[model samples]
Target: MDIAILSVSLNVHSTKRIVEEGQKAGHYVELIDHTKCSVKLGEGKPQIYLGEENVTDEFDAIIPRIGAKVTKHGAAIVKQFEMNNVFSTARSLGIMRARNKIRTLQIMARKGIPIPETLFSINPHNIGEQIELLGGPPVIIKLQEGTHGSGVILAESKKSAKSIIDTFYKMDTSILLQKYIEEANGEDIRIIVVGNKVVASMKRISDLDDFRSNVHRGAETEAIKPTAKEQFIALNATKYLGLGVAGVDIMRSKKGPVLIEVNASPGLQGIEGATGVNVAQQIIQFVEKNGHRSRK
Candidate 1:
């Protein structure tokens, strides 16, 4: 099978590993930089171009490693492939929904998946009330599209929370406020789901000085076997989001496990290293099963 890894660069660790694994599996794989791709729509079927080359029918499947900054354009390219009847690890709509925190949470909440009490409002006048709605003080304020814990903030007091939220609203930045799980102790679970199976999971402990438990934020990671309920939540979250591959983040709270986020194009470096799983190969095999089946 021929595969295309839709990413901005092949130099990225995940992208390189995927290409390596696909080769090791005896499949032809190439990196297609979605950022440099263009789409052409005419009287005939739409065509996707990489520079001057037409790529409409060049591959059997696509593994989109779309980044946060280029999600819209990247998802568009993926959507074009979907229209061409090409199999993709992630659906276009799934990428769009997963890119936004509020959208993902809304879908999760509606699907009866457990999640923290999250609220989003654009009204500057009701900033105080919005914070109070979450029961106030020590709330988790997060950017709607932030990745790797860059825009997540922990406000320890009502005064600070109000100020930070008001400032965000005034600047017209999209954010969400959630009830902070104080018992979490700066730790969270990262579960990697390939197809319908939970391939790997790990517990991420945040730095002593930081509350965000992202590996990119200097968090330490160790392998973990998720409980049956946690495993169920991770798998269902991937299914509801329409993602064949995902990294589902959950925080262990007094109310059991609450999903904090779901990543459409989950990075393989942290989870792979922590769990000692060949996640890249699992992705390749998933493609092998579904990619050929889609051709039927």
Candidate 2:
């Protein structure tokens, strides 16, 4: 099987690991930078190419190592693969929805998945009332599209919340105001779910005072097995998002397990290192089991 590892850099850890694992598994794997690829639509289907080189249909699957900011173009390349009958770990629609926070949270709530009680308003008229609904002060305000703890703000007071909301309103950016879970203790669980199995998990602990638990934000990680309810939340979130593999982030709230978000292209470094598990191997085996391929 020939596998195309779609990523922005072949030097990346997860990208390198998956490419090496696929090679060890006796599959022909090519690392194609999605940023350098383009899609063309024609009579029967769409075709994708890296520069002038046409991507072949013989490839078994595309493991998209897409970044959050490039969700649109990155998933566009994956969608082209779909048109040519090539498979991906995540479908285009799934990728798009997972990248959009408010949409993802709404879909999860609709599917009966527990998440932070969040409120959104496009109209500035509802800002004041929305803050009241969120129970005032120290709420979580986040941009519709941000990752790695970049665009999230902890509004510690009603004045701060008002200021942030007003700023976003002035900038014409939609934002979500969520009730902050105090007991989360600057920590959260990152569960890697492949198919019906929870492959690995890491409890990411942030710095003493920060709200974000991302490793890039000086957070530390330790391997921890999720509870039954945490497992359920992770699995159901992945299932509802129509993803074959996911990184399900959950917080241990007083109300029970609250799912924070589900990531389609989750980083493999921290989880695999903390757990000493072969996450890349698991992902490759999953693709081999599920991906569509044609005779060369």
lDDT of 1: 0.94
Query: lDDT scores for all predictions?
Result: 0.94, 0.87
Off by over 4 Å in 1: 293-296
User: Candidate 2, residues 1-296: lDDT per residue as tens digits?
Assistant: 88898898888888999988999998889888888887777676566778988775648788888887678999888888877788788888888888889889999999898898899887776666888898877799998888888889998888888888898999998778899999998999999998878999999999887879997788999999899999999988888888888999999999998988888988898888899999999999998898765865
Task: Tell me the TM-score of model 1.
Answer: 0.98
| Model 1 lDDT tens row, 179-258 | 99999999999999999999999999999999999999899999999999999999999999899999999999998999
How many angstroms is residue 194 displaced in model 1 relative to the true structure, after the best TM-score fit? Answer: 0.4
Q: Which stretches of candidate 2 lie over 4 Å from their true place?
A: none
lDDT of 2: 0.87
TM-score of each: 0.98, 0.96
Worst 10 residues of 2 by lDDT: 40-49
User: Best-fitting candidate, measured by TM-score?
Assistant: 1
Clashes of each: 0, 0
| lDDT at position 280, candidate 1 | 98
